[model samples]
Target: MSSHQPPRPVRFGILGCASIARKLARAMLLAPGAAVAAVGSRSEEKARLFAADNGLDVATTRLHGTYEAVLDDPDVDVVYLPLPTSLHVRWATAAAARGKHLLLEKPTALCAADLDAILAACDAAGVQFMDSTMWMHHPRTAKMRELVDDKDAIGDIKVINSVFCFRANEDFLQNDIRVKPDLDALGALGDVGWYCIRAILWAVDYELPKTVIALRDPVKNQSGVLLACGATLYWADGKTATFSCSFLTNLTMDITLVGTNGTLHVTDFVIPYEEKSAEFSVASKSNFAQLHIGWDPLPSKHVVTTDLPQEALMVQELARLVQNIRDAGGKPEGKWPAITRKTQVVLDAVKTSIDKGSEPVEIAN
Candidate 1:
């Protein structure tokens, strides 16, 4: 008998027909070990339309009128939840309690306390939990991590800066769910700032900062939702990080890490500009040559190619974890939830600082 084991597919039930769910549905189709088994929405007709529009096979994919029906489906091994920020804790906890693994959207919950409740439910039910930070699964990110972690190549990291911003059109400003207080309470700070905060935390290996201070005079919408904001994070060792996010700027996503002996820069940090390949630049031990006319060493670009998009890779990884739990009786991985909690902690601190008149706030945990 051959020793090769065929891939085990993970059946995913989408909790809502959100726009982001469409991208993940396509990813599930692309992932070899994942399949979209069900789609659910407040409206049955809307769920059916979503399945048809997203090219999910009607024979294979179940359409449910209510989110509860999807959670109650016995065939679903995983639930991909892309609900609004305010709704994550309720739906995610319910899915986990039903023995379905969770692939939740980022800004996992409104705050750390709320996220902990969902995580606690998952832990009690013995189900895996993973936030949908697609870039974390990309090969390019792994390669970059290797370089940044290497002492000789990057030296001691001193500072990190991340920025993620995009101009919102009139429709988005007026009608987007993100700007609605009840929908996404933190607004731009929760939407794009989550990525920036995650990037900074990733650079520091998920270490919590000592203090967080929101920049003064954050731009707010008419409904008192943040439209543009920035924050500074300070570590005990003087390792500092800063991030800025906005809904009123030109499209830009960047991360710059400066070390004692080197520097790293990436233009497209959150989502790669190209789906097929990604690139980052690094420089080490460089100084101006002959009166600053030219440099003796120039930054080198590293390119990583991937056959499948980052989102598909994320699905495959989550599926693999689910398969391990199903076939091998493996304990759920704690790394994803741990990382998510850390990100949420920082996010909470920023929001608290902003609420307190942009005063400095110490991270409680």
Candidate 2:
């Protein structure tokens, strides 16, 4: 005879009913060992509407009128913060002070200083801090990591190029919070370039770039928010990376990595075209065989499949960690916050380079 029980689901409280929260709320439903504790918005009615619209169980999930109520809720083990960039530091720090683990959204702060405050609070509170960079949790990303780390597969990486862009309608261009200076001030750079930067760093094993220089002639909106931009990153050992992002192009998410012995390509790095399977190609030591016609060996396609969506995987990972802390008395994991900080630091360098008229900004160790 055997007896065992399933782990208790970690309760999640969502702060700010941003549109992205709907997807995350669904993800929590799919993730193992996770449950919705509450959801909050500026208005209780709005929060109720979000819950009902998203098919959240209103009978079980509490809806709070103000963000503060969710933070103060005794049952919330963690908070999923999807607020604007400018409000991240304030709400995130407060959540930590109240002993809530944090799963913050991307563009975590307006700047590195603000992020530091949030991090400090989390560290002091002995709580986990993870950013909602869902792509990082995908199974395909793990396969790619294995290949990139294998010296036999892709020798020394030399260069990386990435782009993530999407065309916005007039309404989004004019009224979207992403285009608002007081909200997501970094605009396209914060929204889209964030993925590109994270991909580059992941490819390079989270090594901070030595310097970053913004490309010339970035486009900006009337409100002085970036609409399109590009930046180049340089490493001390001569490794280089370039990325561009925009709100004025067709939907595209791509990454191309060139190494000493091979090249790697992924068309949809941020969000896979299909949820069940994702693919990437690699060409190892490809060379001309005949009279300058074609390469000797064609690139090989690798596919990774998963049952749960990447966002759900993200939620599952957070929930697992929360359970460890609650049931087994384990300390919070530091890996996520560390990588997120590196991403933010590189992002800040890119912003600084742009502000300095495309001048190179050095990244401190």
Whole-model lDDT values for every prediction: 0.94, 0.94
Task: List model 2 lDDT by residue over 178-249, tens digit each.
Answer: 999999999999999999999999999999999999999999999989999999999999999999999999
Instruction: List the candidates' TM-scores in order.
Output: 0.98, 0.98
Off-target runs (Cα >4 Å) in candidate 2 are 1-3
**Residue 36 error, candidate 1, Å:** 0.8
lDDT of 1 by residue, 90-164 (tens): 999999999999999988999999999999999999999999999999999999899999988889889999999
* Candidate 1: clashing residue pairs, number: 0
lDDT of 2: 0.94
Clashes of each: 0, 0
RMSD of 1: 1.3
Q: Name the weakest run of 10 consecutive residues (lDDT summed) in model 2.
A: 1-10
Give the Cα error of residue 212 in candidate 1, in Å.
0.6
